[model samples]
Target chain A: MIAKEKFRVCPDTGFKVFDTTEKLIKINAVVAVVFLAVGGLFGLLVALTRWPAVHLLPADLFYLVLTAHGADVLLFWIVFFEVAVLYFAGSVLLNVRLAAPRWAWAAFILMLVGAVMANVAVLQGESSVMFTSYVPMRVAPHFYLGLILFAVGALVAMFVFFGTLVIAKEEKTYEGSVPLVTFGAIVAAIIAVYTIASGAIILIPTLLWSLDLVADIDSVMYKLVWWGMGHSSQQINMATQVSIWYCIAAMVLGAKPLSEKVSRGAFLLYIVFLQLASAHHLLVEPGISSEWKVFNTSYALYLAVLGSMIHGMSIPGAVECAQRRRGFNEGMFGWLRKAPWGNPAFSGMALSVVLFGILGGITGVVLGAEQLNIIMHNTLYVPGHFHGTVVAGTTLAFMAITYLVVPLIFRREIIWPKVAQWQPYLFGLGVTGISLFMMGAGTLGVSRRHWDMAFTDAPLNFDVPPAAFLMMGLNGISAVIASIGGIMFILVIVGTILFGKKRGEDACRTNPVILPGGGATVMAAGSEGTLKLPGTIALVSVFFAAFVLYYFVNWKYLSEVWPLS
Target chain B: MTEHLNSGDGKSGDSNGGPENGEQRIHAMQSLLDNPFLLLFIGVAVPTVLYTVWGVMEVVQVPIGQ
Candidate 1:
């Protein structure tokens, strides 16, 4: 039970910050960054290995690095930070003490042990089954065990989040509906529970099969169940990052949603429809039915896509409305131009929204199409699309929020403010290049999983186009740049937390909340709360144009292929 | 003076629980979306049926590979 003495009123935000909640957030965030560095190192090796010019790692080492890269960054680093976000959202936003603090620690321990175990297994080289760790690829038992334990731990953290909500309500933290950011986090937590459970359902049996406790696991069954966990984990990231986008918009720009009902409705659509897009992974499988694929990919999946489009409109629309109200109303683009570009939080968020929507959202619908998938499935395009979503979108947004989290949660000023300002552009542009080049190579029919694109060692090599080789080289160079950006972020955050100057008590105790670095909090400059955001309308129209153009281009590409009866 | 864009609404619907509006009620009944227990139930249950269950059933009916 939390006592009054255990709670401190945050001088900046005025949220009743629980001592345990703050500590948990600090630990989770620090550990998450550690894994990010580890994952980044492995990822650089992977990119170099993929480059025809460099080909850094041997084939075996390449697979090992690839396995570690996927697991560490995608599964461990992201989830750990997400757990931190859950604590921040569920407890701090609601102004409630975290429920079951001891249980939260237990969850962290389980996940850490699992992550270490899984990493050790991969390094041993016998368990290099890659991220999917598909059926028939028997691995070291600890590999599956590590992942299983990790999932269970994450599942426990979600329960703690849920419990914190219940406590918020009991203590009467706030009146009316919960805030929208908290609402989005709840959506993520719920999806996480399902994802972790799905992981356990498939992995436990696979663990048994690895030990020869079961004779054989069906390949088709494994793929189907695995993606329920695999891809849904991504869906969890999508919801959470989108929530962070809203949080950042409010913090830096003081933006509000255009309409709560419409925004919440979009989140609701995610709950009902987002995970079905997981079936996109199985669209190429012959065992799956056309009826099932059609429904999952296009029919129902479009509803989920609509959910994303709604967010794309509303987040910027909110920002645009906020900017105009601030009297930045010179022209359609003035609000955007006069907006806080110097703020890494705002820039990172803007990049995440634009790149993810334009690159990830468009290619996602394309790959999900059962017909279109015939060209792109299992190609470099898949990773390219996710790099846009996870790296450019989610990871960048998370990095953006760290600018605030350091000052707000950690009570520290950023070490190098200028580097922090430029970090997002460097990382965002680097990853954009990475994603684009990979997509280009994929379009040219380059393989995704192969270590040597040149096939210098293959018995019989089908020559890939020279452009594909050029794209692969460009992708490798981009990875180097992104790696530098990623390392810069890690160094800045680490320096800030460990050595940067501590923020003094907010003598001002200003209304609303104080922004990090004494930046402007989003304010109400308009009386009616009504602004005709022609700029947002224009920006979104541009997005729709790009989407329409890309969609037909893919169809045209599909048509140029050999005819099938 | 809430950081969230809730200008004149007097509700602190921002990320940080903003300044409390004058002496609001102890507890408020939220919409179905705001109810975590109910949302978690439906979020988990529906996805299981649509993606996991429906998918596994389709895979189950497939004849074993030679």
Candidate 2:
């Protein structure tokens, strides 16, 4: 039986006996990091194999490893960490315990089981469906079973988060409104529910087909629903990463935004528009109606980009506001000089935002354009663009959060604080270097996911300048360096866990000098208490109008084109 | 050190005492039911059972990707 002491709670102080929620968050973070590292290694292997000069790994091994890497790192690691962040948002940020701790653990177990089964099946060569897991290229039944189980676990976690929010409201733990971070998390969780549900619809049918229990499933239908999961999940990633930016900025620099109202409003905008932006992926795919694709990709996606721009400006605006308060009289860019650069968390966030804006933003918008996409589709540019946003933006934010969370939750001093300082720089430089190289290669027309271009009739010419191959080789080398940097990060975390000093008497010191007034300052100063009912109503009305307009326009065109078959 | 850390001193500045704390404790207890572990179990189990049952019911035998 679980000990009563383990389950004990102090209501007056709002502390749990075991601090299970905090423990679970740390565990999930570590697990996700491990998977991420494995994924990175796999990625490096694939890049090396593809490089013209150094074809290190064999062809079959290359595809298999790439599939595993995408599934484990991109899908599993990011989602699991997001769930961990969801729990942190619910319990810690909102100052409410989980609605169901037992159920939360159950979800973790299910995800673990599912992840294990999927990984084993993939490694054992029973499945090689790629990360997309497109039908026709089938895997064993267990692979699909594992994927389904993982999705279900994710869905349950989402429900628990929403349920916790409702209870927090009912109990009146905090007055007026949910915290901004928690609010963002709720929006992300809602997106997750839709994404995972769509994934379930696609994967479950395919799983049956793999087992010889179903004769055939329509490939077109599978691709359609699969993107629902694929694209929606990326939206969730975007929302959660943006929210983390806020949290990390706040914690690291004692920074508050110029206007909490604007920041929170931006989050709400993401909830309404982000999923629609996913149509950008389907733009180049065949079988989808041109009218539907055009509307979804161009108009809807532009609105999503508008939301991203709002967030993009707000982070700097918040920093500028904070700096102005500190009496920094420098011009627009001078405020950047006043910003804290020594603090690893602050620097990491600052660099990530800049990289994400210039590299990720420019490339992404260009790729999303219908005409430009026709040229760049399925090319090295696609991965380069995504890596800029995901690895440089989202992963870097997660790394920065580790600096804050490890100290606060685990009560462990970080090991080699100076070495920890260089991690963001090394990793960021490597990623940027690799992405630029790939972008250059893409400009010269290099295709993605190909094993050997030399064997094909239309082989990539080594004769004529060799610039593309040279760029690709540089990208591979950068990946190796980036992998080393990632390893250094893991070592720091492990060392902190094992060898760092534990917070003894200091654990009871509730107030830190950094955050002078603690929770009260945030609650009172921020927009939580302000009820901008008019603004909220206006926002909702705009969303509804946009939805109706998009629906009618697309419906009219689609009807004319297809004529209901 | 462990004993000293665990021991409750009268001078220790913990505000709420015994029975009142118990009431708050009960409220907190009620919240844990929606924990991720329990949700995860239900999420995985329900889907697994449903999918397995569906597969069993369908008796088609064609090679994959035909």
Candidate 3:
């Protein structure tokens, strides 16, 4: 018989928490926050350096900071937290033991070591090739090796997740189809396997080339393989974040998906067409052919966009449906208005859905279009778009879910409940400014990754528009504000986990976070068992308007660049 | 209405799913995701063929140092 001590039940929700599983979630999340703090600091420095007036770091250091910022936040921070999410979704949600707890520990150690090794390589001042590290621009051999190790570790973690799912099925953990959250995680893990495999296929050879064991690694091949890894990493984020969006909605507001069929179909769409977005990074490449480009571009990009757009609607529709059932029906947006805006769990997910869809989703579609790609391909517009997606959309979504994670998994009261309420808005506002201003600077033709915006010593002495300078100044200020938001999130969570009272400890205060307050009591007529989401429809229609206007705007901008005369 | 959301949580006792035993006896959407192996195969195979294989082939056709 298994050790009874290994399995205990959460009193609040009755989730079967394995002792090892809980530790893995806590440890991985803790480490992810550490990297977020480190990476966010570098990001702030990079932003200051970009601002013409501030010019925080010199050219050499600017590149170093940029490279570190990408690797740490993009790779280390997000992936570590994702690993935690994977375990929670699989073992915890399925109510099964994590398959091979020994292997899980080994995976954690390998990941931790690999992350440190890569950081060491970057900080050593020799490997400042940035995250892409495109071929013939060799980075330290250790950099490639570190990443390879990390990939191997992640692959191992994926195995444990899959194995646990098998255990759930065989043991009959709960019943019927595994939770939708677990299903979304399954999609993420599958994407991760494909992504990490792509990384290995390219990185191993690159590592050999770095060590002078190979003559050449083709640049075109590198681009193909690397983006299969790189862009797909974000795809993993999208799938995982959407899953958590559903989870937070269910846990916080007791919301059901408006249509489970539509929501699952949307996730299924990701499995089908999402990775094709690798083409977005390669649209401008010369080694690639026209037929190849067009086929990949049109065939893949928009279908994937359709998948994201589906999610954009479903999340809000579910939220509004839940609110209406609670008797909040008044106007088109009454359900939205009465939503628990003060609850970080609800607000964070809502903001992520809106910002990601409007800013990230729409801008991304335009960028992937061959004609529009030409104009914004090398501009700060690219970074602007990603900030909207990655930081504003994915990171904010992750931050939102962390509110739930702390209470649910960590079993602590939020140290400062009032501050927790406003964290998402502050962070959301800052990143919104970052994405918008950067895109504005990009529109005025600012270079994406260049250290010096002024070009003080260039031979041509070309002058960038004064407006672009102002945009970068605004972007710098936004970065500082976003960093403060990041700090606040870290402080709130860290303080809570380290020092806050244990949940349900005080008899008088029943831990509002555990059961989640702000519930609506009665089901309004015509609302019960109906998917009438006028509020969500109005919200999505607004998104549609934004997308159409932006699409035409970019096309018009393209016309200005290339005269028909 | 809210407890209908438990089909997602898969907790016991619900009209949408789960019997009194806490084992969800049946779920309509479960068909696709229930089989981890099949989904894994589909997810991995579809992309490998569609994106990776095709892209690598195109890259291989490029002339070097021409």
Which portions of model 2 show Cα errors greater than 4 Å? A1-18, A453-465, A505-565, B1-66
Per-residue alpha-carbon lDDT of candidate 1 for residues A432-528, written as tens digits (9 for 90 to 100): 9999999999999888888777667688877899999999999999999999899889989999999988777853253222344222222121122
What are the per-residue Cα lDDT tens digits for candidate 3 across A186-282? 9999889889999999999999999999999888889888999998988899999998887877777677666565666788888877887888788
lDDT of 2 by residue, A1-33 (tens): 423324334221223324767777877787788
RMSD values for the candidates in order, in angstroms, are 4.4, 10.8, 4.2
Task: Point out the worst 10-residue segment of candidate 1 chain A by lDDT.
Answer: A519-528
The alpha-carbon RMSD over the true interface for every model, in angstroms, is 6.1, 15.1, 7.6
Which of 2 and 3 is ahead in TM-score?
A: 3
In model 1, which runs have C-alpha deviations exceeding 4 angstroms?
A1-5, A457-460, A507-531, A563-565, B1-30
**What's candidate 3's DockQ score?**
0.28
lDDT of 1 by residue, B1-66 (tens): 122223335442333333465433222223466578888888888878877777788888887759
TM-score of chain B of each: 0.53, 0.36, 0.50
Candidate 2 has a DockQ of 0.03
TM-score of 2: 0.79
Residue A337 local lDDT, model 1: 91
Of candidates 3 and 1, the better by DockQ: 1
By summed lDDT, the worst window of 10 consecutive residues in model 3 chain A runs over A518-527
